[model samples]
Target: MAGNVQGESQFDVIVVGSGAGAMTSALVAADNGLSVLVVEKSDKYGGTSSISGGGIWIPNNHHFAAKGGKDSYDKALQYLKAATGGVVPETRLRAYLDNAPKMIRHLEAKSRVRYAVAEKYPDYYQHLAGSLPGGRTLDPELFDTSVLGDELPHLRQGAPSNLLMGRIAWTARQAHKAMSREFGWRFMVLGLMLRFKLDFKWRRKSKFDRRAALGTALIASLRRSLQDRKVPLWLKTEFRELVVDGGRVCGVRVVREGREVEIRARRGVIFGSGGFEQNQTLRERYLPQPTQAGWSATPPGNNMGAALEAGIAAGAATALLDKAWWAPTIRVPKEEKPRGVFAERAFPGAIVVNGRGKRFVNEAAPYLEFVEAMYKDQQASGAKSIPAWVVFDASFRFNYAMGPLMPAQIMPDSRLRKEWLGTVYWKAPTLAELAAQIGVDPLGLEETARKMNEYARTGVDSEFMRGGNVFDRYYGDTNVKPNPCLAPVQKGPFYAMRLDAGDIGTKGGLLTNEHAQVVREDGLPIPGLYAVGNCSAAVMGLGYPGAGATLGPAMTFGYVAANHIAAAA
Candidate 1:
């Protein structure tokens, strides 16, 4: 129950969410002499963004362009258009590219953000129609988390450390080889890590170099900057209603600790609250399958689709509500732990099988392809085939690196111990026994294993042609004799985990104009209302083109919205 509210408490700008978009907008507005107030519905401040890959793909940036990389406006626009399947209006793509570099520079110079290009991370479709290899993504260099002082507790960390900002290191295969043969590269990587650890340790930090820990660094820097600028961040405060006047939003009705307060804004209100991924009712209605609806790589608390719902109720145009930033994840049932096993599937030599106990699809295929196949399997006849199992042999477990398994190396030992305390799962010794434990047809499983061993012996993938792609081969261990991907699912004691369609988050929300303004159903711009991040259907449409696609657009459009607001003012 919220108390009746209101005197009109005013701010130059009132941002409704504490995500990167909202926070960036607030900081920009505040630094430009606007009195800003950021309200977050969750108990914490940073939303899903705080636990993300922490990459802002800003192309043609002056800093990056000087560092031996080149990205033209034409190239960036072409890439976006191709990635979006040509449905993305040219004007919108132009706005994103034009503003992205400025935004990157602005934040780097004015805010606490420090960025550098992910020089080695390649575009997902680099060989496709239009793509820029390294220029497309910009990630923050590890920031000084101590800058936040007391605000450190409010930050969120992603589950997997490798996906987090500034945690990139040589792969497990590369590390092993370097340590064994190339002592120079091994020492170099080890020395860099040692220096990184010592730097954090000297600062009296407890844990550093985790992916989630790295994310916390960026959030800390942002929070400290916001606090320094005196931007009021209302944590545990939820946006309940939009106070619209003359068909334009002028303020918001916020519920904080059961009290309603009306926050009036001079310029506008922005909805950066993410999608409704965790909302059971909405997911069941829009998502492809019942099992795919609830899983998330981020935290479970990111169920706020309030922005999208409120926008629809207020007659805003919506798009792609039935889709997600789709991903295929091994659903480690409710009893097991929930860290996404993408690395396991993405890693070489792993194979996914249906209940018929046969390799159904290419395990090392692109993420979207894997997800689509999972949806396709759901349409098949057998009830047992609906949720498939991702099978990997003992070779897969010990040789290849799986997601979040090495917690001591990737995440803080505490978080590793906390999240994975009792969730260690593996099966071996006999395929039949493993099948029985995982509830698959034993005969089918055995047949699948026999066929896989045949393919492994020949060093070719006959069914799926899995190692055919450059991406698949990029993660493959070339040293493996025959079929890097085909390691004879014959290892005594096979391992299988039940998997369902998982996602980074939901993908559908308010439709926005080139300026990132929320567009009405009739295609009229809803002044004073802007939406970005997962609160809007991505400009890239239904598929994630690359690793940083989500963060790339979120920051780019966020920059566009702020500039539009400033120019209008």
Candidate 2:
């Protein structure tokens, strides 16, 4: 299966994976006059990053400055300390902060990568010290995939759930309007309809959409930059072993198309092959029970931990293996992948309940916080909260979308006859019947519903403070009177979707220092080895500060790794 190769290839830097972090590292290394080779295990590039929201939380970014937003380094550090609680060393934290702006500038100057400030997106912990309401996160501008030419088909597509009309990409803010019935929204929807109609011809030819947004755009832009640099990217290449010589990682053995090949990395090998979220063995060994591969939002075959395993075998120390970028996800029977639900839980007329049919936390809380509450519930009572139910009434079903179930969209008769949907998504004419269908205590659900309805009537959630903060209110409906997040769940024909503990990816892997060099148990750098993205232990410790927390550090550390290698060279 080898394609006309008889011997080994060589490069100054060898990067594993083709996600944002890996591509950034490769591009930066190439910019520094290093010949870099990017090898991806999967047939396509981008990994899980292509399907993400493509937000990068870079404080003091140029976009923020361009928008006249004031952000100080000291204030950013204060926020980091408050969020991480001193768990992350000041040096590593400083390295991330100092390099983040540099990384953004470098990418914009050196490549086609460009970003716009998500001016209205708030930090997850907005009330915390040094936190801004917005202006820290950068979203990649939409990219035209037509530029990729033949490589377009090989690029990993964005998550289908994130797209609108199977091709158009909409941001959360855009979706808010598009879902509304306002005159402005109607005009926008009309425009989108026309665009989709015109795109039908292109879709027929390409078999995929050409307008890439969010993470898809981020990856496509990186791919274009890499192509311009003439960097060689080998797909279907699986890293087998790190070839170490005298305690230095000098080369790697990779299996490409069923044939093994040795490639020498003269300067360094950067591992950004993602986390262990898809590796069942590592997930069992590291994460808690019931939080394995099936529950992850990462694409299939991702985060298999091969890179981490190789690093560990080479004596690299690991950290934070028990943690992940947690999110609550619902498994749709018809969909091939589990969909991560965020805004739905925060909308009025809905509530999430555990097996005991009790609301344990504020439904309007951030997704990560919601999962943390679930974890807390599980710790209190084993497996009781693993499959929590997101209960909603007819009003909610008609007003808002939940996972794959669109607002006001009638379910087909064929799917309604299935028993699994009855089991997974309980629908009943009465609250007690819905509870019974989902195998919960009917009386308990009735009582929970009664209390929630009372809260809705009064516009107050005394029990868990459902709509207490700005962050909670971000996803709430503004039109609703009093508290936007409070609405009576008294409508008949209620529904419930089973939700499980899921994650964007595992957060733990090989430990790296300020320079992004993989460190051993002895606190010494594993020479010629570096790691970024989920393949490296996160610098945020265990706290998620804002949107794009995962990718911000990923790209920054990748930049750090490449610059260090270049400086040494």
Q: State the lDDT of candidate 2 residue by residue for 274-351, as single tens digits.
A: 998998988889887766688888887766999999999999999999988888987766554677887788888899
Clashing residue pairs in all predictions, respectively, total: 5, 0
Residue 244 error, candidate 2, Å:
0.8
- In candidate 2, the residue pairs with backbone N, CA or C atoms under 3 Å apart (3 or more residues apart, or in different chains) clash, namely none
Count clashing residue pairs in model 2: 0
Candidate that scores best on TM-score: 2
Per-residue lDDT for 1-569 in model 1, tens only? Answer: 22578545998678878777777877877777778888887777677777655666666777667787876877766677777777667787787777777877788888777666665445666556666555566666666555566666666654443432235332323332432223365476666577556665543545444222334445656787888898888888888888788988888888787878888877888787888887777888777766544456556756558888888877899888887866655434342225555445645546677776776678876666676677776576454445667777766655555554442243433443454332344465788887777777889878877777777788787887766655555455566665555576666545665666777778888999988899997889887888888888778775566656777677677767766777778
The TM-scores of all predictions, comma-separated, are 0.86, 0.95
